[model samples]
Target: MMALRLRAQHRGFHSRRPSRARDVARVGRVNPPAIRVVAIAAACILGLTAATFPADEVHWTITGQNSVTVDWRGGDAEVRYGTTQALDRRVEAVAPEPLPFSSRGPFREAKITGLDQNTLYYYSIGGGPLHTFRTPPPRGGSGFTFYVQGDIGGSLDWKHVAECQALIAEGRPDFVLCVGDLTYGNSVGQHAVDTHFNDVMRWSLDAAYMPAWGNHEWDKPRSDDLRNYKGRFDLPNPQSSPADRRYPYTGGGEDWYWFDYGNVRFVAYPDPWSGAWADWAQRAEEVMAEAEDDTAITFIVTFGHRPAFSSGEHEGEPELQGFLGTLRARNPKLVLNLNGHSHDYERTYPQGGVVHVTAGTGGSNLEEESGSGCPWRGGCPEPPWSAFRAMHHVAVRLHVENDRIEGTVYCGPAGGGGSNTNDIACAQGSVIDSFTIYPYGLKPGAPKPPSEEEEEAQAKKPAPGR
Candidate 1:
């Protein structure tokens, strides 16, 4: 398959002969104003040099699980990494094949493996001049923190992007999880994708960005979305069953995959955008079931474009409802559901178990209330299942400790305070809600495992809708 085959092309160099003094004299004699022309040429060259000397904008992303992938845009892709600032080592890696759209549309990506677990590796991308990232430790190791946000695009609110960058700088997360809808491509064209990343690079200092697929990314067709996503990011494509070379074992088909970092298992799945959630639902269930055997898999978090339950403007899609139901049925331990598409923030608790939180307000304008009967709206009066609901700009932060996992839903700075409120404008940067989940057997008198009756009750509850 084209995805698996690694094709490297070498561009042959042909040097040009240097101009000699005789040639210069001949040109000068033939010109009516050689001195003037030389002066003009020198001025133009100086201007060009000044224009090109601006601090270069650097873009790099981190992917893969135990083995991390680093890619940079706007310059050569290389790495000078080590534990100290000296960066005593250097390694050359292949640059990613050019992808269509803009000059920087498709950034290059490379995988760095054979590293120790729970150890920090400071590496610079594009060799040395610029760009760098810190590799995250494998799962079940020392605890670490990462930032999570979604639905950020180049158009609309650029300040939100700035806020996100400031948050990253403050938190200094090992990495960032951009849930989805990164580019406002749903209304625009492919060019928007490049613009989106350019905006991100402007704000992103040194954080490793990992993105999921959103519906806006499906501008042309499902295949186009896959191509653009793959072309832009370096992700793991698990070799399909030992027999099939075409389809890889990656979780969500194209952008779907699983990775471990500091006692947490992150499963990124493709949203139902390409009409493949049914198939993905089954695969995801299987992966979760197998993960049950490993006690270390304490936190099971999934990210996609659509939310299982939301109170925002686009909440009532039947397919989304079904997908959420299936996902909840399959993975009871699913602690968080990160999404982006609604352009607002919301958090919903499972009727019986599971906590469904939506961080779709990453810079995108706040979506008007759909007035649908979801938990976000007042329609449900008192949702038996929902623990907290808000309509505002915000992100979710997960802090994984040795024995417990703590989560805080952070609203935008504009939001009045760190308190929950139905007012969307007053919900920014506020600690709308906070919760913690302990290991199954670690805490005494913890809630018992849901019985079949409780599971049935959860399945029968009204799902989120438009």
Candidate 2:
């Protein structure tokens, strides 16, 4: 295979000391337009010459407020990074420890720590193309955006996945919040995982990826194992994994983790199939409780594979609903619950003080609505809490500001068989849904709910016609 190389355009090198403004400005230049120009130029160069570089499946993992873990395969054990395009700093990369009875990985991880917060750094592995990534700002920073999706990646659904990837690249988000079913490890095996890692290398070039586990990540009954899924992707808080009663298994490394990006406390709750669902639920609540006490945290968002309430074919998970509803009812800071597993797009009407979005429309067999009663912890009407439902491949981009959270759902090609089985078009990508939610309460200048006595007096008053 031919290899591509990106030389540092600027040759100036700075001292050990770093300048925040200079670095941040350089970081802003890594936007989509500049990247497109660079990619086109690289393509032209690739047609004329080829080089041999073994590094493949390169990606970034946000490990902490000031740290990021970079992973790749078949590269020299060294990484070069710096605040400037000159790429002056260096770190030695090492292979991840092998897991017993799982896929033997040659994945190498290099954790860059103690870096400046919210600053951009350019890096390269073994003299490869220069890549860039931005560290998240301090906890209360609130101007960033990220993408969320799940049930992504399949051999047959490559077109949909590719289209979704294009949208992600164009937006150039700070990171991607992967809710689960990333590569369908149970169905497609190691090849699928590797392919996904490579496919993500492009769009995730400057964005950190945070993942939650899905049921497909664990191969149940056969080996009851998390094969390649565990071997790849370095996640935060692996040692905090709760004990599983069933197979002496602990694939909850990536599933049970949380991080504060900007003012939002993002929590990745364990997948429901983990056998220790109740324990995990308690743990998730504890995380929220902690976030609630932190003044820096303005909103809390929880995500996992299975949906607590969905209009799609799969039955709602009452167990999850019970846990999430309790959080929403008690904590006003709990704003959104993201999920997948139903294989369609659904957005609830802020049921129980939280907006629920089921974005399982990412490159898998689309599921139609099940006509069953709307499932909520305290009972909901027949039409369901779902405000919008569709059978199209889609992903949501959330713009989180200090006061409100804005979201836009972008649709892609036909999820399955390239036909519009549902009313919504499965054709070109476009914005299908848009919404805004004020985390603190009603938006500014919005009217407040009336008191009981005032409501009673208003109710007693007849209509003007009457």
Candidate 3:
């Protein structure tokens, strides 16, 4: 797989204002044309400089079972790698091409393929720093952990930045699954993408990061145009690529895609707020049908930026509510639905054989009504599907194994604002919510492990068919 080519010129490079009076004067004296020429020359020599995230801290996207796409802000599009941390082997990445304006910089990406499955490999970008990554397990292999969150970026008071650092240092998730609301960019531009990448670079440096479009991603000043989002991330292009469509796709570029890991198949589609409802629904139906026919797939997880069922300030999308209700009716393998946009954490009771989880607590301001269901601002009663809710910032970790999928919601420090609000305060790094789902062979309400007393009582009872 070739790395995605730079499609447009961007100004993602962070420009620092001259601080000293003399420095400012010097900069002011420089001519625009001269500055442009100098910048172009520098870019030609050193590659575009990513002021926010250094080239060494590369952003990763899992493109296939044997390949991963690594992108960096400013550097030679070169990656050297091998199975060992020594990086004895190497591969030259595609060099960055020049854009129209010399002042703007282009994001450099390289697609590394032909890697050994389930093997640990160490790589360095432009010989900057040594980083390690593990490929997805071989087909049918089932033992991995991935993190999930949404609403990352912005709201410094929310502690998302620090929270993310801790997640990587301790949890070290294999990859990240984000439900959207990625950057709180007020507009559609490089600065917005830069700010978001800066906030999450720590996680991106270590693990493959996959995201679905959220309202904040597309509902910006340049509405409906996801050039930045699409250009930055190289998602699985199952429909467009010549390879057999492993799963159904709506042919929306990175707007939607699907991939598999171990026994789980993850399908990311757009919600009504992000894309056409009918188009995405059609893809969802196709994926469900495929999963139903493939007996090897033990779990089917779908995620997006907007929630199909959420009690946060934004509430749930009414169109999604109906579509999901029907989708889950016939697809039991579609056990989990992940989403964000509510600015809180919520888990629904098994509704129509599937559990919908809203994990919008990834930084950003905490909504009083998020997960609370009371709608501190006032409205209709809480929906019956809501099982667990919390206003604290959090990131979820899912342990996907052969028989079950276990999830643990790890909470971060409470955001600013005194205790008078509806937000729940919890010790940072505490597990606020946890649950297990047996998607293959278990009764509907049979999730959540039984208590010791219940287990003991069952043991005392006679065996079945005795």
Using lDDT as the measure, which candidate wins?
2
Kindly list the per-residue Cα lDDT of model 2 for residues 1-466, writing each as its tens digit.
2112222221100111211121111111112256756964885788632223357766778888788887766556678888886878888877664442332344677878888877778887776677777777777878788888887764333446666777777677788887777775445444556667777765666677787776666534353355455555677654245545553345435547788888998877776544446666667776777887788988889887777777565556777788877766555678798888767788888877778888876565554422433322122343557788776777789888887788998877763333324546744657889999886445667654343345678999999998
Candidate 3 pairs with clashing backbones:
none
Clash statistics: count for each candidate: 14, 0, 0
Question: Candidate 1 on 5-97: residue-level lDDT in tens?
Answer: 001111000011221121111111112247856964785677543222222323445455445665444444456666555666666656454
Badly placed stretches (over 4 Å) of model 2 are 1-52, 98-105, 155-157, 221-224, 238-241, 245-248, 369-382, 415-420, 445-466
Q: Worst ten-residue run, lDDT, model 2? A: 10-19
Model 3 scores what on Cα lDDT?
A: 0.63
Model 3 misplacement above 4 A: 1-57, 94-103, 154-159, 187-190, 223-225, 238-252, 273-275, 369-382, 418-422, 440-466
Q: Against the correct fold, how does model 2 do in TM-score?
A: 0.78
Candidate order (lDDT): 2, 3, 1
TM-score of 1: 0.71
lDDT of 3 by residue, 1-466 (tens): 1111111111000011111121111111112256756875786687544532345324788898898887666655567777765677666555333211111444666787888877777777766666776778866567678888886663232345456546644676777887776765533223434556656766676678888876555443333234555666778743321111321222345667898777788988663432356566766777877876676677888888777777765666667777776666556677888988776788998876678898876665555633544533324455677888876677788888777888898877666543214356678788889999887336555663443345678899998898
Estimate candidate 2's RMSD in Å.
13.0
